[model samples]
Target: MNKYSYKDLPSRRERLFIALRLPAHIQHSLRLSAELVQGKLDFRKWTDHRDYHITLQFLGDTLVSDIGQLRKTLRSAGAGFQPFELRVSGWGTFGLEEAPKVLWRGIEGELGQLNLLQKRIVEATSSLGYKAELRPYSPHITIAKKFLGQVPGNEDKGIFGVLPEQDLSDNSWLIQDFVLYVTQPGQTPMYEVVDAFSFS
Candidate 1:
């Protein structure tokens, strides 16, 4: 999706979501990884390092008045959980093979805990009128979008041909908190954290 100015956001309703903010070290590592293949690839937009996160739930175009209640609900929901380890995994794409719409880095480690936290957040927010996504939970940090580069082998070989073989086991970090963020377009870091919910 193209950048939308603050005025251009849907009906001026804040685009909000719940997510786990990656640590600086993890962000730096992912940034370096993206830099390694950026020149070789042809993607229109590479995600800003500050924007790197694992989305728990997307509450799109939300009412400004609802934010306080959302924060309260999130804090209560998050209090039951504890910190869990997670790491940046492999690379992949979303959309079609030849011309994918999104280029992303996958996630690994403590996936069951992550899913449980996500499920709790969804349930907590349901009474506030936010519906859970129909799609199954698949945690990933998006790196780029609008693929225009060519594959090495056959087009059917997909995005893996250009993927770097990097050992990211050391990229693991303890996710201690989740954040509520608002999307602000026409900015270097489009997403801004409004509040954070720390795990007990």
Candidate 2:
């Protein structure tokens, strides 16, 4: 007789997602972009650069019991997407400039492949009981959220407006793998990669 049962396995509910992790250099570049306006903004929670990533699929409040199944599904879903080059192109927000909910950096290059991979992930998990967000998938690295108020108009224009010509997006990173992450809400550096599935 076994001393441990499946019921006795350690488990916890998690807010989770699968994402493409950025390299150190690209990560710093994004932080620099946000830093350009850090002093000007007030009452906003900026994301830590270390947590920057491009979310492919968000699995909200996942049950610990379902992880094994999800892992297998993710591996199957991720297999067809060969490695691709991804570049950060520009900035965008979830709402109007004057009243934004989330500020993010936009993605370009090989996005069609990115979308196809995400489509497979969504389709794979739908039958397993994962519900994809209804909104169309827009890939970006969220730089900040929970905006309490807006920056002064001139400064806002300086930052959020059509930004002045800059070399922010010239760097490109190869995305060879995607990973599953567990997010710790109300914690510093919320997303932690728990497992990675590589593309062939």
Candidate 3:
């Protein structure tokens, strides 16, 4: 018989953060819109299209040993909520006027439902010993980061001539399922369908 150390095990066995999927059409539109502002106003480096998602809760890093219980808790917590429609619109950045670290768009409509979903997710995973977020939840899909000065790498002043404003269209989608995702630095993140408890 041979004994193996924890470091020798495969990395895929790690636990993941979980979130809800954004509909394809809305994602496409957001990508196009982002390109229009690519060189202007010190936008944060953009996230890849496939990485786009509306996070319900950030589970942070967890040991592989804990994933099984997390899944079970999510299933139980998610059982009561039914599918709901969410609309994506508007854009903003975080930080002071001189420095913005994140650029993202806001979610609209079905606000109550979204909040309920987040609360349940938090409740489900709270017992895992992770630190819970104390601030009020504000749902937004982050598009960019790493922004420091006035649009670094661009010398053309014209690039900052016009900044894009938020779009207020009613782009909606039905949320049918959520997912658990494992993110690793310098590697593509992996996702798994923990359990899809359907909404009525």
lDDT of 1: 0.85
1-200 per-residue lDDT for model 3 (tens digits): 01334355534355466688776777787877777777565554678766788888877766655666777787777775788888887776676534567778888888998898888788778787755688898889888786755555444543324446664344789887687766655644234444454544
Q: Tens digit of lDDT per residue, candidate 2, span 1-200? A: 02234365537566788888999998898888778756655436888999999998888887676877888888887786788888988777787666678878889899998898888888988989888899999999888885566456654453455343455655798888899988877777777777899886
Alpha-carbon RMSD, each predicted model: 4.6, 3.9, 5.0
In order of appearance, the predictions have TM-scores of 0.88, 0.87, 0.80
Cα TM-score of candidate 2: 0.87
Candidate 1, superposed: residue stretches over 4 Å from native: 1-12, 151-158, 167-169
Residue pairs with colliding backbones in model 2 are: none
Which candidate, 2 or 3, would have the higher TM-score against the true structure?
2
Off by over 4 Å in 2: 1-11, 150-159, 162-164
